[model samples]
Target: MKYPLLLRFLQYIATLASGVGKRKKLFILIYHRVLDAPDYMRPQEVDIESFDWQMALLSKYFNVLTLEDGLQRLQNDSLPARAVCITFDDGYADNFTNALPILQRYKLNATFFIASGFLDGGRMWNDTIIEAVRNMQDSILDLSELGLGKFDVSDKSSKNQSVREVIQKIKHLPFDQRKNYVEYIASVSQNLPEDLMMTSEQVKKLDQSGMTIGGHTVNHPILSSIDLNMAESEVLENKKHLEQLINKNVKFFAYPNGKPEIDYRENHAQIVKQNGYLGAVSTQWGVASKVSDPWQLPRFIPWDKVPHKFMLRMCRLYCA
Candidate 1:
């Protein structure tokens, strides 16, 4: 069966299971870039209009709560009916410019997990790779010499696929190796964009204005791929940096690439707990429940745009 049809059937069953009523589980919605125009180079981005609509829907149908409050409720096993928390990973400038307004319009609060190393005019390695790949002068650049496979960047679709393939190949590599590879690509490609991340001032302002600022590693390195000491440093340094920058305690964390037992592991969760973080979130898909591990909280993004379909997807999550 087609994916959409399957999903629709599942949603229907979920609706029947609960009469499409709100569940007691806590839903943490995650996002990345909220751009006025969708960043073609970063296809994972949500445009401002779509974001506005989503927030409006959440405001109307869900009991959106602050991250701290939601976590406390989860801890006490007293999560409100249909509890929800909004979060943005990899603090982008557009979070301040685009997302902030929509959030404010809905009178909602959100937590932003910042990769400290990207502040003050720095870009994540993935963004660097995307910029480099998108700007390549040659349609079919050969990288077999680097021991990576050759790419066919003959058109927009091909270039996008090439970018994804290269990033997938290097993402789980040790941090230094991935950085070097991305830098090498940037050197060979042309017209790399500058400073895609939020500045220290922007971060400070966001925190001051009531948004929770959280840590997301120093350079967004996958914790399980690096040495334990390095991973600890990444987690600790990011927390300390955000604390000093925002002049407030950085309480929460989100794992880089956040896959359970893949991008991060048990030891990394231990590191986060040892660092005094209240809890850490992962890219794992599920609603938060009383039995859920606070140190490895799972989160997911809702992708449907149609209102009823989106609501049904939320219903599915509630039942899942």
Candidate 2:
């Protein structure tokens, strides 16, 4: 079926299934980077063409709102059918260079959650792993010295796998330990990209362009892997830096590696709230409604490439 027909059919199905007085559902779409072209090491990220079409579909079929507006209406029960809020996590420069123009073309708004520590030439640890593996001259990356296992980077496929394995191995480690591993990988790799993240000026430009900016911690640490006090500092400090940079109150938060209970806990949510954020989002896969906690709002991304299936999947999430 064509996209328009499928969307209409799905809308009718949703209306009939939801019946009367069903609480409004808010679908928060999460993104990391909108790449200029496909990167084998980060295949899941949407490229320029893919992101263009996705935003086109969103503008056409859904009532796309800013995060602040969406949550406020979700509370007041005033949301239109098929309401959604687009959000991007981490402060990638492509978000400004690649994602912003598409968003503007569609006249849509999105929230960007930034890891403040990575702004202005600082790369995230995972990106360190990805870039290191991507540019490695050796066919094999033997990390047995670091006890993270050896891997074959003989080709694109192996390099991709090695990147994933190495990141997973160190992702949840203590912050200092993870830093050491990432540094070791960086030292061994050649020609790593230094300009992966947005500069502070680009962040302010995003705000000037009328997009919302939210906090994603200072260092993008896994909150569960760090002490509570450190976690609190991460949350608060990020908000502080962003507000200072943008000259606007950063009203929302997205947990770094935003998994409930594992990456973050209830106390982390409390910290976000107490720090004066209006709300926060998690990496949970579902739709949010009135009964959902504002501090732990759920987020999802539909990975379907086909238009109809993608819209269908979105409808299913609403009814789920």
Candidate 3:
């Protein structure tokens, strides 16, 4: 869905009305890749050139702040107008080798959300499946042996999009079952890409370079798919891993998949706080406030195809 131009104008007007004359803050942009996306299941993981251009545009107007600073200023009401914060989810290796230098060159800082498990040969199952399908040539991939229904990977021109249909079939399973299905595909497939996910060393490099590390659950599981103990364990294990890696207080979180169905909820927030995290972030889009629950803040995912749409959204907030 498109953000109406008139609606944007109204947001600007509201900012003016709430605190006339000062710049107003607008967004928290969530990204996951800086190099090529293994597959484009979602558009946020655009290539480096597109990311460079997005940064160039954002650097022009906004005072991009680290996630903590943004929240603190948001509480103090000290943010400039057109303010926004940038975040990288899943802690892709490229965020260090590719995206970080860009932010550093622009002298910008952002929160780097790390899925504790994916570091050091831990590939997200979703990413593995996307790559696996992209490499496969056959129209149909049958994995009923692994207990999943058949996957038709061919073109969907005369009918629905083949990839979408395949993805729908994949998504139809229970979360745990679907991950196992991806694992089955990856184990059987060849021509796999580099473990595109980050390593502990890379995360340390970012932390030492002055970036903030946030907890994403270990194994990247859907919290709701499991019982309360398992969900708490997911949160605890992630925080423990990052703290051990960075040796600093890790206080933030990004919900895996960021959907209500994916295990992010009030219970998740309680786990975060009880584990001593200061705040948490969600994949849902919008601006946040001091009054906003830090454990349930909203985030805007930057789309790969449309930089102008990004520009308009950030004009109403901030970006890095």
Top candidate on TM-score is 2
lDDT of each: 0.84, 0.89, 0.73
Over 1-320, each residue of candidate 3 has an lDDT whose tens digit, in order, gives: 13587446544543543453253454688888887543345443677777777787567545678888888887788876666789988888889988988888777888998888778877777677766776676777777786555766775331134445555566645667887777777775687876688888999999999888999888777666667798888889888889999998898888877865454667877877888987888876677765677788888777746655665555445322
State which candidate has the highest lDDT: 2
Query: Cα deviation of 72 in candidate 3 (Å)?
Result: 1.0
* lDDT score for residue 210 of model 3: 87
TM-score per model over all chains: 0.92, 0.94, 0.83
- For residue 114, give model 1's deviation from the true position in Å: 0.5
Please identify which of the two predictions, 1 or 2, would achieve the higher lDDT against the true structure. Answer: 2
By TM-score, the candidates rank as 2, 1, 3
Query: What tens digits encode model 1's per-residue C-alpha lDDT throughout 48-74?
Result: 877887787678667799888998988
Q: Is candidate 1 or candidate 3 better by lDDT?
A: 1
- Arrange candidates by lDDT, highest first: which order? 2, 1, 3
Stretches off by above 4 angstroms in model 1 are: 1-23
Question: What lDDT score is found at residue 205 in candidate 3?
Answer: 91
Model 2 alpha-carbon drift over 4 Å, by segment: 1-23
| Model 1 CA lDDT for position 83 | 77
The alpha-carbon lDDT assigned to residue 218 of candidate 2 equals: 96
lDDT of 2 at 93: 98
